[model samples]
Target: MKKLINNFTYITFLGYIAFIPSGPYPISVFGIKLDILLGLVLLVLILPKITQIGKNYPSIFLISLLFYLVTTLLSVIFSEDIVFSTSKWFSMLGYILVSILAPIAIDNYSKIKFSRLFLLVVAVVISFFIIHMALSYGLDKPQRFYLGFDPTAPANYQSDSGVEDIVDPNMTAIGLTLSVIVYLPNFFDSHHTKRRKTLEILAFAIITFGAFLTLSRTAILSFSLSLVLAFTMLSISSKSIQNILTQISKLFCLLLLVMIFLFGIYTLSPSFINGFFARIENIESGKEDRTDLISDTLSIFFSDNKNILFGQGYHITNPHNEFLRNLTSSGIFSLIAFLFFLYTLYFCILKKIKGNYWRYFSALSIYIYIYS
Candidate 1:
């Protein structure tokens, strides 16, 4: 029964990830969101192991997270709209719970392998769906397609209706970014079978294209920087000159293949290339900028002394910066807690760099830092 419970917990966790792209239009059964239902079920299954969850993690890291949660809760209590704040707080709690429990669910090599494979499959399906939606809506459509039940906007776009479940393009891009980074290291390794290599290459190409379709500058930048960080760390960890040389060669080959694939897509659809470069040019020309938004958010954050200690509450405005968002919404205490958590997390990943899952975690750490 214990074994069965573990299996159920693991499968439920996988189901949660698989439906992440469908977050906007969450599937429901008898009015309960499927993802939330799965999350609750997962929590119940893993409740017995809660005490053991912290055994492997750093105490400071856990402490900082607890502090962060407490500050967030205080913010929620002080919030004007308690319902909205409570909902948001619960969502965050669920995310934290899942992260803490994941190691227990996927405790072995075989489970890890299966989880990665599941992610690859999920990425491929989402990529293809995005591609098809883009083509259907025309590449020049004002709004990009997102990962959800429907790519098009709803007829009734009410903010509170809960039916206007349009997932953000940036969110979809981030998910694809993660999927790409996860399988990217396989290209550097030499032991994979030809079929495995081919699948990885195909998945990588398709996922990359899908991310490009989102035209999210942050996602693109994060993906690029994460790859560079991963490569640099791997190079530094290399023991011999020959291994370093081989890694360099592999990197060059991989970049060449990516360029060729992207060029082929450009030849097929020049509009996508034009649109992508136009976005970059807009930033360069100051046609699109976030400096004003950042400045405005800072102004509001500092407008009141009390706001500095215990924030003005959540979702006041779109800050577009995670640290600023936390500072403005939850106060300085939450911000410090969050920063401490990340600092410890970075060291935690560094210590494990020589371990089996170093490559994935290293890339993921960079991704999280950039995204945040």
Candidate 2:
């Protein structure tokens, strides 16, 4: 019985990997791959005897979950886009599942294998994706099956960089994150294997370069945060080697920042990136719509309005941001649950792992949570 349960979990893991479409992340998976994680979560739930609750839930994860739950509920309540919010909830649930299973999946000894396979699949998928995109972009043609996002086109970036037909930076960012998480761990290689070490260096470079090409400032920021986290998680033979690694990481970050500035100057030509700057500056003005919507929705929620509390069938809500979206659809209580999920996971890493190699990932997730 134990073997069968374990087999089920592993199969679910494979299914998750196999579901990837032509790339490293889930912009596409937002459609087909959405349900698989939820399914796995449900599977675990069905056999509580097999999946220990304490091992799965941990304490820190439990706290962040509360915030997530509350945020989700509030967002749904105020979201003007109901259908969008419903779809988003699925994503939230998926992240939740990942948080629940990921720590458990790697536990003590498997972090290496899990990290390797994860990195390998991501590197392969994105490399193929970029190759496919490059061909289509170069040809200025799209075959029926070739689905791609080009930021350098008339739609996104046009003036400053002469970059049209570049892929969306966010999509690339998602793929890059997956790739980093997979390869950043030292466990994938052997102590004496020169080839593996070379691959590791090459892998990091490719992922970092690809991220630069995306020309996404926010994405770039996330990558920086993730890298610092990765470095923290890693270990070296001597203080000198560690210093070398640190210097290289700083140089990489500096170059990336320079590239982003140049790209911004080039692509946003029509408005000279000022328009870009203004748009970001405009975000503060939109809070009225958000706050007003939330305030109105709270009336329904507090008055025992079951319809609002349970969620309004998917159109009157979609709080726009992750925090707001959760509260409207799920409720304030659930919003807190979501936050608990995030913080608890952070706490788990800090509390559980005691190693030099884990510094990068440990500090990275916390940084992401901070910015998020």
Per-model clash counts, in order, read 0, 75
For each candidate in turn, the TM-score is 0.87, 0.58
Q: What RMSD value applies to candidate 1? A: 3.2
Worst 10 residues of 2 by lDDT: 138-147
Local accuracy of candidate 1 as per-residue lDDT tens digits, 1-372: 978877777888888777643323456777787778888887777667678867877887788788888988888877767788888888889777877877766688667656766777787788888898888888766565766546665323434546445567777787776765665444445777899888887887888888888777777777766665666667767788887787678668867886897798789778877888778677635735677777777887798876787677755546777888889888898788878887887776666554644465445545463544
Model 2 Cα lDDT, one tens digit per residue, 1-372: 966856565556545553332232332243443335545554464444335546555655665665555556565555556667667666566556665655465354554456455655665566556545544454222221122454234324443533233334455555565555544445333463887677666665555545443433455566656555445444343268767677567557756865676475446343424443443465446753545666666665565655445544333444444555445556555555656665666556656554544444535554562345
Give Cα distance to truth, residue 139, candidate 1, Å.
2.9
